[model samples]
Target: MTDLPDDLTRFLAGVAPFENHPDAIAPAARAIEIRYLREGQAARPDSGTTFPEDPWSLYIVRSGAVALCDSDGRVLERRGEGELFGHPIRFGQQAAPYTVQAVEDCLLWQLSAVAVRALAERVPELEAFLSSDPGARLRRVEALRTRRERLADLGLRSPVSIGPDAPVAEAAARMAEHQVSCLPVVVDDRIVGILTDRDLRGRVVAVRLDPDSPVEAVMTTEPVCVDQELKIEAALVEMIRRGIHHMPVLADGRLAGVVSAGDLMRTQSPHPLRLVRDLARASDADAVARIARSGPALLAGLVEAGTDVTQLGRMAGLITDATTRRLIELAEAELGPAPVRYAWLAFGSQARLEQGLISDQDNGLLLDDALDADGEAWFLELAERVCNGLDAAGYVFCPGGVMAKGRWRMTRHRWRETFSGWMAEPDPKSVMHCSIFFDLRAVHGDVELAESLRRDVLEQARSSEIFRRFLAAGSVTHRPPIGVFRQFVQETGGDASKGLNLKKRGVIPIVDLARVHALEGALPEVHSEERLRAAAKAEVITERDADDLVHALRFIADIRLRHQVERLRAGEKPDHLVAPDALSGLHRRYLRSAFGIVREAQQALAQRYVL
Candidate 1:
């Protein structure tokens, strides 16, 4: 321990993947060897190379330069001494995929494969850095293997255009010939409008607008556009938010090309903004309903795009909430005004922005206190009509009828009174309601009013140790599935060997723990990951522990999204059920390690909550 370098020791801490391995530390430190690249011994592109079975080397350039090259003499990437390389070859590859050449005299750390493995066993950080999917591997062998460079090769082509003044018939013909769904309408070299197939169906065809009329008359006047140099992720987020069918990609001042939702869907870019745009464009409850149903599909795309799980859940929830609100808005327009001023509160998954492909409506209303018997009658009727409308459109009613129509959940003052009573003397039932209602987020109407109630509840919760205890007890009720004998516990039922409900067991524990922490700390943040981080920063939880929880949640969320995609492709419904056999050997190991992080977080939560 005295001989070990501080850099090596510091790097080993909080490495979740290999944290539990008994021999994880010493072997890593002992096996690493440092060597200097000879002054003139420069390797080059297409240079002949020696093959080794497992003398895996960690090449850290100490000085000068090095180039990663392919057999065709193509220079792949250039690297400096402070950077590490050769990760791809570490897993027992007989030959390196690309040759590494010394551009000048250099000092290198040639950590042996045996040492790397030993280090991985000892250092969770090293193990995670080394153990990545071969197909998905793109670690820094050189600085040039960047996403920006990869996107350039994707080569978005220049888009075809038409003048807004051009006849609709001519524009339609051009669109048909090009076999594209959209065209940018330009006027005097400036883009003025955009036209899409949906617009054609909804407006032109439905209204029987003459095709011979000017395209400008029917074209969407304000088109959503993105700068060509913007990252694909940014662009996708924009598209989702705006609910546009096409985005005109502009480079400098010129139109480069167009990107559509279909193009993005096919590529599986983790652009939640695009989904937002799709939701925005939804014209009716039925159309919005269909688009809302694609939440899991969008989530899968986000996972494939390598989105962080925190962001993934946040985006997913936002989309779902938006759709639900849209349905409510449409219903209000169709039916009539609510009997009084009311705040529609989305409960459970929708409130948390955690809805799956198939989710039931879990919403209730907060009505103004002016209501008497007549007002009550009006609200009851309104709730029934809106919920029925939502059901007809797609969302199934909550089996327990937790909607606004419920007599127990109808009035705003009653809700406040209920919270006050629960806080006065916390019980199991009170704690359960807090668990559900604490996660409440207002989706539509008088948001400030909904927030006022939340503010009141948090105020009462902050001072009550008993209330916090009940909340913590409820949170720890669902234990992580780590086994008594082995480090992990797998399924033993019909789907035994298939993955357990990662959400229910691993992720939700963290979520619930975070929720408890938030309530105890009196934090107002609604997102679970945010609540956890905020709690940690406020000294309610440790920084190291928070980091573990965040990473574990992201890893598990990534796995869940991938499995959801597989199910969707197989024409099966997306689910929390994951088949372990479907996972690759590497992924299986990752999944196991990821869950271990969850276990640690849960244990920490239990200790802190006094559960």
Candidate 2:
């Protein structure tokens, strides 16, 4: 190897993987062979006749462009300056059928694979560089979030066990000694029941039960529990739904630890595991309002921590659910209990749990059909207070009066009728209502009402072919803003003229596709990703297409999340409009890719629903 020229050495240090290794420039220049590849210079190797002597070589583009074509002559990938290309180096499984050819005159470093590998071993920095695949590296930056840190990551209280045959007094003593709220009652080294302090206070002392009685007599058999591998946010949702203070944590199908509200508070409070708990205890609108204001800051923290957009959406939805539920509780406390059971329902984004940083609250109420005139009057008053409280808490009421404060949205029986009418008619407004109301979920109260409505909606859509067509029409209403030239089609005229509304033109198309497919297949999910997965599971959509749609949805959603995070950091209100000019070359490229996927998805939907 000869000593490197200064210009050649400088070029090597300028690219990524290499950008971090300035010291590698001299050694790289000395050991690597620089080939000035003129336009279409690299041999095409048609029929494998033009293959280089040692085809196992790494190529780093210093300038100009290169395109790798498959054996069929399809341009499989395009690489530019600072990008690396070489199948033999990336995937070392014999010969690859792709031809590496320069698209223009280029200065490429044809590094010997053997030497690069040896250099990588000696230099730790180069190892990271060499290990990074360019395509995967971008996708990794796009990696919004992985699964929530599992519960095992949140160090738990040591497992304390007591026999089911032990006296209630001894169980209580054990809890006292450990300062724990609950204890798993094991029999034959397996948990059969659990006794909590609440059980002792309510079932034993309150009833004046014999303290010497077997713990099994008072213990809750088969108590609600969670696995140690579950995410904290998911655990919070389950615990909140069950109205339990503590849940037994399991490992290897046996009791491993007890995770109390106190533990979640310590670990996830600032992130909403504890925020939900506080929302539950919020005694008044003022208390709820205070916590709601913190939502934006909390969201900012999540985005900064590189939380995945999907996880961020779920957290936001949980916060909204907890906030709304708290407001309902305050309303109930003030207005007195309802004459009949009623469920508070969320619609649209809230229902789908795709709520972003800013959203107008869209919700309704599902009252028990048994409500009389007085009951109706009581319910209306409650709705007024709750909706108003929510508005004050930053969930401004829907400008379309879509909030729970409406009479039309107040009854479960009428809701079914409303769906039937919409399906039967399928007018513009009715179709619009169908879009909003179809993804309904119970945010609070009698969930069975929601279940019944879900069943009815599926049945109604299944029986009505015309209704499914209308749903398809609604889905294709908005096209992704990517144009025929593989360029962004910006909003020509409107308040959003600065850029495309990433929400409407990008995210919503996939959401609408998911909604249509889910309804068509009678999938029982409200979330877009869940609906997509469920639809795929039923074979309604091929697995590859389904996966493409899912990836597109996440990537588009991540772009919006990033935009919102940027606005929040700049102390400005977050919105979905994003100017392509503001994005980097890589970002714009991915944006086009994401929007392209949505276009393909819409075409798929259109082909399926031929009206």
**TM-score leader:** 2
Q: Across residues 185-280, which tens digit of lDDT does each residue of candidate 1 receive?
A: 877667888999887888788999988889888889878777777755555555654556588877776787888767665555534555566666
TM-scores of the candidates in the order shown? 0.60, 0.80
lDDT of 2 by residue, 1-611 (tens): 58677777777666545555566666766777777877877643344532233534567787898876665666655677766666332322123556777789988777787867666765554432333233333344344235457779988868998998899999999889998889998877677888998899999999999999999999999888788998776676566556677888889888889888777667643666667777888878999999987887787777676666776787788788889988888888878877898888888988888888888878888888887899988888888888998889999989888877775455777888888898888888888888888888998888988899889899888788888888888888799886543457788776868887899998888888888888878888989989888988998887666776777778778888889989988999899999987775446655665676677677767777764
Candidate 2: stretches off by over 4 Å: 1-148, 188-190, 240-243, 306-308, 371-374, 579-593
Which ranges of candidate 1 are over 4 A from the true structure? 1-126, 129-284, 298-302, 305-308, 356-358, 392-394, 491-498
Deviation in Å, model 1, residue 233 alpha carbon = 3.9
Overlapping backbone residue pairs in candidate 1 total 21
Candidate 1: Cα lDDT at 442: 79
